[model samples]
Target chain A: MIAKELKRGIITENSIFVLALGLCPTLAVSTSVKNGLGMGLATTFVLICSNIIISIVKNWIPGKVRIPCYIVIIATFVSILHLLIKVYTPTLDSQLGIFIPLIAVNCIILGRAEAFAAKNNPATSLVDGAVMGLGFTAALLILSTIREFLGGNKIFDLMVIPGFQPMAVFILAPGGFFVIACVMGLINYFRGKKGAKAKV
Target chain B: MTDTIKLILALTLISLIAGFAIGKANYRTKDRIAAKQQAARQGAIDAVFPEGFKIKEMNDDGGILPQKYWIAFSDDKLSGYAFEMAGSGYAGDIRFMVGVGLDGKILGLTVLEHHETPGLGSRVNEVASTKYIWFPFGGDDKTKPWFTEQFEGISTLRPIGVEKSAGEWHRLSEQARAGLRDRNAVSAITGSTITTAAFTRAIERSVSKYLEELGGYCCPATRKKREAEAGAAAGENGEETEGGDDS
Candidate 1:
């Protein structure tokens, strides 16, 4: 059961490519591999903690006010994570900046709470959170690697080619959109092909 | 209704727990965060000055100068002054330190904090390098950011010019840099002119005025005259005067 859920979260219901959630932070911080990893881990930490807390308190929370209650839990975790990052990893804290706090509103965390965690057992919810967070991190790594290499002719701040003139646009807003669209399109293509073969 | 009460209770309980957790987290991390910030500030100050320089914090005296500034002394002689300056950039606030020599020329500039668009405006603090990772032989890594490096040796007395057409400072040759220095200008970062302009404008707006006032304060003749005046005024009033020896 855990393996099925893990496979489902990491591939079938992957947050970025499949669900198209949390694009704001993904685009903003995916300029470099380091920033993407930092943001991903920060978001992952928030996701895991919030998922566990919401699952534990799912019984007491009223259906009518569940959203706000979930938000409060998620925000608390994000704030704590923010403070810890600020103290322990000041460089990552500065790099991630507002996106760290903005993780509270990342639909992935709230969406998981409302959709999966609210109804699931704590262990299952924890698994779901971890898988989903890993999925998001995977998507970010792929996107950032492409963007960083194409935009700066470097990977993780290390130069890739000797004196390769990078296309500066790949580091800009338009480039972010272009990269996301292509990646999403590629994922959809493979998924569509697999669905067709299964039906056949 | 009991249903409404339950809703409120649930939210209130969760919020209370969250608040407690956040407060506890803040309490735990506040000291470490402050220490980190202090260390960064000290590092920025040290970067702007040479080795073995002593920093002395000067009282603002509640004068027109709004920011707190420090005077740097080397071997009992005034070396330069360092102060924090802030201005709005393309995305958000950009705060940095500026060190100016006694001659009003900028010694160095370092960005302390900024919230700018990553990969673009943030390049203001980036040290540009052409060194390849595998080869890593030909080009050298830059210690200071090219954007801030260009500001060194530019006089704060004159209005600093941002030449957009001249290209980025790192991309320019030696002759081009010399030409820019002669004209009291620095090349703006491509596609981030606002960030570059904001930093230079901040230096131009604050440093020159503060240096003038600081010069007057450090002048021995003016110091003697001001002391004599303060003494006479204190004798008459029998009380300490404002803006006198408060440092």
Candidate 2:
């Protein structure tokens, strides 16, 4: 159980893909390797930090307003990230564009604040954030790598196909829709197999 | 009453633990995070120039530009300078960096920033289509060509100054200059004339500003070399340097 917390707890493949959290940036900035990485890393930071905060104050939050309280904490962290990125990492701030602030609605952060950290030990929650965030980042990288490869040619400019004429649609908004749909299908297929294995 | 007190105690202990953990994590990673960000910003500056050049000056206009930068070369072979360049592009302000070399070459030109609409007007940085379109073309239409190769080989140093001349236009290449001096010379981007002219005029005015402010921009080398060999017939005749003024 402890080991699982570190591997797939915070940012799980299911939450980000199967359940579909943080779709805004996932679709908007997945056009290239650089944008994907920037959005992934930034979102991870916000997720980890917000999870820890919500866990700390979980008991103090009024039962009637726990949801609103969690949102405020998450929004606060997102705002700080926005300012710091604007001052220090102008390029990425521009690349990620408006999606950065959409972190407020990024269900992954909010969902974890409500589900895992709000009830678990701070240590376990921390581990959960790291692992889950990694899972999300990994999923993003996989999806973007495929989309960029087919849509733009070259994985992060590494040139995987030995020079394929980009499929073109893979880089546009429609391409994002298709890539996410395919990834969601893969996740569902594997998850169903696991469910069957468990039944056995 | 006793239960409430117990709840408060439990909450206090959890807060203490959470605080300690967060503080430590940030302490461990703060240095690395701050350092990485610093390096990235510095890297943006270094991307424009080659090594061995030291920044001899620094200034900023402070209105969105935030900085005006000038760096001189140790060998005196090149002096590249950059100023915040902006204009009312189709969508909004098109922000970019324009760096110029001492030999009148554009050391490098990168659109450092922008806010233009994505699919239609953001092709400014899409170098592949930049030659022809002033704006972006959605997926299937991207590789479809529309630009004439006439503008090929033209760079900032060749025909146009950062500033436009009255009835003047940017010459794409030295070979192409003879045809560009006419007031009516040069056609606009097929579809987005406003954007093309905006970008052209923006770049032309910018290059011209640095040229004029730099005290004497040698017309591009190919032309300069020719003007030198001919001794500028007007100079040999002791007549006024007519075209040299960029009139």
Candidate 3:
């Protein structure tokens, strides 16, 4: 039972890469390690908090108003986080930009609210949120690190090799789409092979 | 009359309850939100000037504070000022924090915020690339090492250097500690000359404002002649006031 949750959160599974969710910020702000971390942490806070609250109120909310309720709860948390980050970490605040508020529509957060939290106890829902958030953050960090290093030839601002011809395109919008394609492609390829072997 | 009265009374009662609840919630959170904003502002000030600063005063026009602040040093030793600098680029607004030293030299600068068109204007953020002001003129900042070097120890008299773009002039003047303000020239960023010039103008204006408005009467030798020119201009305008008031 414990292992299942761990597996679901860690490998054999991923929220962003494998599941193909929250691709907007995954490609947009994941251009740097710092951006990835900031977005990841903020998402985790909103997801966990939203999941817990949505679970508690799931029974009380009319089906018609459920989506709106979840959205309000999520948006409120996101705005608080946005203002908090702005006053505190202005650089990170600016770096994440509009994506910070777009967490309202991140789909992953809302998807979990409907699929997992609405049906489960608040306890499992909270864990599921945290795990999913973590999974998403980890994937973002990996993709961003790859892009920054290959695209800019500097990992976290420390120049490793003196004369590296940075793949100029890797840091732009197209580079972002390309990186997503590659990451998703890899996940599908490996996951597919594993599933095939399991069936055999 | 009886049905109409009953409906009106019911509606009024519901509205009253709704208003009271909303008002009470807003009133409670109003203070909390204000406190949070103050804390956030304090945090930004601390991060920028960890040495600590004084509010000194506050001014605003209306809803959007074009420049939300006017912070000064507590010790009075630090001249110049720190504030949000902004301007229109080829894309959206480019915003940044500019720090000017007492000498009219750029103490430090950091892009606080911006939303330039990606690839074209976004290159401005790539430090060390020389594609933008990412180069540090002569500082420890790896990305912008020494590009701002041109900005250091510059003349506050003429905000725009004469012949060439401003950056080149700053670069040239750095070699010599000439008291004469160089209106010579600085190399402007190609293709994005307008963008580069706009940023330079913002920095120059902010620094000059600090010097003229609040730099006190201690005009450096570089500004000596410009001082005379300014006095002459004031005389021409016939707005010359008596004595000095360092408010």
Candidate 4:
């Protein structure tokens, strides 16, 4: 059952692909696979930690001000994470830059906190956060891989196609939308085929 | 009424706890963060000069606000000076470090912080050359970035200006590559002339200001004379002092 729920987040309710929760950071950082992966892992860390804490203190939080309470908790965790990253992993800190602070306002985190963590047990909420975060990361990775590979003729900064002329447009802002649409179209096509076969 | 009071108390308690936790984390990581920042600045300074150069921060005797610079030493002698260069760019301030050699030539330049558009203005930070499989259609062929690399070996004594028109380099024939290596020319980023011009102007201003203020100390002969004068003054009454050491 828990396994099924986890799969649902990764597939059926994938934040970027299926639900389209956080698109701003998705588009901005998806210029490179490395940046996408870094952002994904950072968001995942914050999500799991915040989900567990919120679950533990769900009852203590007042209903009238729960939203503000979540913000405070998320902001606190983000600050701690930011400080830790800056101190221990200065390279990643500089690469991620402002996005680390932006993670606090990411809706996927607060959405999950309100919908799942607040209502569920600590263990369930933890799993949900992890699964949702992994799903988000996976989407970003897919999008960035395509964008970086085609746009820069490189994968994770490695020269893949030795003599390919990189299409500079693909790594730009509009390229993000084009790639996402194409990927989404492919995913939907496969799903539609499966649905037709099931009907038969 | 009772519920309202309870809610207020709960919110206050949560905020207090959250604040305390963040405070603790900040206190724990404050020193490490500061150290890392210092290391980053040192790394930038190191990149501005060639190998085997030590950077010593100079005191703000002239009281230049927000612009702190350092002097470089190699082989137990002064080599060049690096300054924290900044300018109002397209979006926000573009900050960089520039190494001006003893002969008034730029040794190197490195962008430290910037808030330009990601794909366009942000190209200022790009170090690697864009490669093409076939003919190099792009005029920029050097492994180093054309924007800053052009400044290398170019004397700051001349006025620097960005290539304002397109195909300016393409129009120049192979024979003119050397003779047309304008001492006062910098290649601007395509589609981001504002940012390119901003950085070029900043470099020009900084170099001229440095020349006017400390031109005497930059040359070997003048530096030796200044040192001898300081030594003689010290022997007489210990009154003369150069810029104080920052590091």
List the lowest-lDDT window of 10 residues for candidate 4 chain A: A154-163
Ranking by DockQ: 1, 4, 3, 2
Output the better candidate (2/3) by DockQ.
3
Question: For residues B96-204, could you state the per-residue lDDT of candidate 4 as single tens digits?
Answer: 7788888888899877766665545666755554444344554355544556665677676777766655322423455543433554676666557888877677766
TM-score of chain A by itself in each prediction = 0.96, 0.88, 0.94, 0.95
Query: In model 4, which runs have C-alpha deviations exceeding 4 angstroms?
Result: A1-3, B64-67, B74-77, B89-91, B115-150, B155-159, B162-184, B187-198, B218-247
Instruction: State in Å the error of residue A190, model 2.
Output: 4.2
* Residue B120 in model 3: lDDT: 28
DockQ agreement of candidate 1 with the native complex: 0.65
lDDT of 3: 0.61
- Candidate 4 per-residue lDDT, tens place, A1-200, comes to 87897788789889898888888888878877778898899899989999999999999888898999999999999999999998888756545667778899999999999999999989988999999999999999999889978876766755566667778678777888999999999988998999999999
Model 1 spans > 4 angstroms off:
A1-6, B135-139, B216-247
Best candidate (score: lDDT): 1
lDDT of model 1, residue B142: 72
Candidate 2 chain A minimal-lDDT segment of 10 residues: A6-15
The most accurate candidate by TM-score is 1
Off by over 4 Å in 2: A3-13, A33-38, A63-65, A79-98, A119-124, A193-200, B1-81, B87-94, B101-105, B110-201, B209-247
Per-residue lDDT over B1-247 for candidate 2, one digit per residue giving the tens place of the 0 to 100 score = 8666765655556555545654665666577666765564355455445567664545422211223455656576446664445656665565554455655545544454555433223434432322212222332333211221222223554444222232212224454454553322343432234544554566565555455445443323433455467774322221221111122
| Docking model 1 quality class | medium
DockQ category of candidate 4: acceptable
| Best of the candidates, DockQ | 1
For every prediction, compared with the true complex, DockQ reads 0.65, 0.08, 0.09, 0.29
lDDT, candidate 1, A96-123, per-residue tens: 6677888999999999999989999888
Tens-place lDDT per residue, model 1, B1-247, is 9999998888898889889999999998999999999899889988888778998776443333433567899998888988777767886778888888999999888887787776678777767877776877667777788899999999999998999998788878999999999999999877788988888887777777667656644643453465576674322221211212121
All candidates: interface RMSD: 1.5, 9.4, 8.9, 4.4
Measured with C-alpha atoms, the lDDT of residue B184 in candidate 4 is 60
